[model samples]
Target: MTRTPAEPHSVPAELGPYLREVVHRARAVCGTHLVSVAAVGSVALGDYRHGRSDTDVTVVVDQPLPGRTLSDLAAVLTHPGLPCPATGLELVVYDAGFAARPSGEAGYLLDLNTGPLLPGKVSFDPAESPAFWYVIDRSVAHRCGLPLYGRPPRDVIAEPGRADLLTALRASVREHGLAEGHLGDNRVLNGCRSVLFCRTGHWQAKRRAARAVAASEERFRPLIAAALRSYERPRSAATELPATDVRTFLAWVAERVGEAAGR
Candidate 1:
């Protein structure tokens, strides 16, 4: 059953129906709060190289839950005959306060002063990002769609004003990064975005825009130096900054966090 991901048995063909099934199951458990759901990850991005890709479905609730509650949501995602590496799912509850902070959609965190999901306002404006990240790929943006709540904004995707088919992948990216302490999100997208552009080269503006965020090239110095030096370079060559740079940013972020706490 686990064949290399390629033509003939392309992932979408095999996973499309299976993924929809999982979403249905998730919807059943989520009830009113399951505002949206979709297929993400290797399948969504058309890059399931070999052996097992999880079907990451995101459910944005009407209310955001504490980090601990998200663990409970993880348990609910598992069920029989699921094809994903594990019935993996990402659950984000809407809270205006949290939405106002930076976060990653396709796994890139940002600094949001507004925008919350689940019973809160979730803004997807590209203007708020500091030079670190800015452009919003339609596909990635599509993944942020609140399907359960109804369709998402039509303009944020690749084919401006066209129906979106990439939201599923972006939604999964959100949770995928969160699950792996964000190593999965950041590292994965650094490469994913690269391939994405290779395939959808038309949206140069959006790709370049994301470069600002990916500019944290030094964000995972040791990790990047040791692992894959995957670079998504439309905006900048930030995939290879020294690891120490990332550490410095982290420290700065920590101080800001502390300042916020003190106030």
Candidate 2:
């Protein structure tokens, strides 16, 4: 079942060696049980930035991974052993059955969060994590994933329904609005992307989606531009958006997603 990546040439030059190493380590750990490896998120969307973006990857396996395998995977894939080149590496391993018929539920076998910007945690229990974010991630991966180790993504990953996506988007927008600390750039850009997805049911890079929203929603042009500027800069140079503007933007996006769901 294993084959060359569907679009091997599409991978960024800087990521080639790192991703290959990821595959090698994964294969060494899981052996024949590993079904495939696919690159998702900004990397797959062709908007990856060296110091600003996290590399998101999804791995599908023939069956649930044992505790020993999970431990070995964490030991080898996390920092020091197999250093991540990007800001972080957000890898999720899912059973093949769950991947083929996904739902708005926590069904992952392993949720590995590593790197500088991300929390260095490896989660195995579904009940211990929030389901909405993973649900949205699965939806995006199904639509935009680029295969790196096996069969094409669309063959193994099922796209969640429009209603499910809208529900997840609404929850995400609300969470951003209520969350504390510094997520200014993430809030505004995510708002832009959410609204665009609500209207079009399509996925685009955050910056690209912001530009598309800015073109149509004149009122949010300034906010969108600010978000874009902050997002493009290195992490140390990133700027925060006004809290009031971010709240308003998220509210508007949540309303839009709600409306889409009703329709």
Candidate 3:
């Protein structure tokens, strides 16, 4: 048996070219050290919305690369010459050994967040970072990832543990200032998704999951409606939601998710 090359068409057209460029650049830089590349988040879940999503790619390496190789890969992957399809790109690199482990803290070889919110920066040795959110990321990738190269996602990534997911959810809400969380589309939708994951042990796309939570729980309707509208028209000033309502909604979600975790 032989491994197949990545199918460029696996990603949406908006992200296809950029992703192809990334794969080529990574292969050029990492060579045999690079194990696999997979697409996670909305891109893999088949609910990606153009102009409102980030292209998320995870590349696995056989082992920790030499600093020079890691730096080279970062330079090519985060180069400004390659424009992302949407807000930005989130490209993470992981070690194949750690990724294959059944359970433990996952180490990232490199993590890059390039988008409107922050300047394009690449980091090395992210094992000590408190904001390691790979628990949910691994879960999503294991269940719904779109492979670009090497083995399937389930072959490389382990299912995230429940305790880890709850901790990540708490950290997310806490960073959002609990009751005073921002009312941006991502913020609201993520809050809804966290709540849903806690309750059902399943992951869902932002808008659909938000709608589901809203439908099941009447109290979340107004906030979820505002979030859906914002998602539809992200740049429209006309869609700004009331801050007070957003605060209350965040508080409600935080409380509910906390309760769910306790169960």
Cα lDDT tens digits for candidate 1, 174-262? 43333343332243444334323434532322223235334555553344343233333211223444445444434443343233334
- Native RMSD of candidate 2 (Å): 1.4
- Please tell me which predicted candidate would have the highest lDDT against the true structure: 2
- Estimate the overall C-alpha local distance difference test score of candidate 3: 0.76
Candidate scoring better on TM-score of 2 and 3: 2
Greater lDDT among 2 and 3 belongs to 2
TM-score of 1: 0.36
RMSD to true structure for each model, in Å: 13.5, 1.4, 2.4
Cand. 2 TM to true fold: 0.96
Q: What is the model-wide C-alpha lDDT for candidate 1? A: 0.35
**How high is each candidate's TM-score?**
0.36, 0.96, 0.90
- Mind giving the per-residue lDDT tens digits that candidate 3 earns over 11-53? 7888777787788888889888877889999988888877667
Model 1 alpha-carbon drift over 4 Å, by segment: 1-11, 49-52, 65-72, 79-139, 143-150, 153-263
lDDT of 2: 0.84
Clashes of each: 29, 0, 0
Report every candidate's CA lDDT. Answer: 0.35, 0.84, 0.76
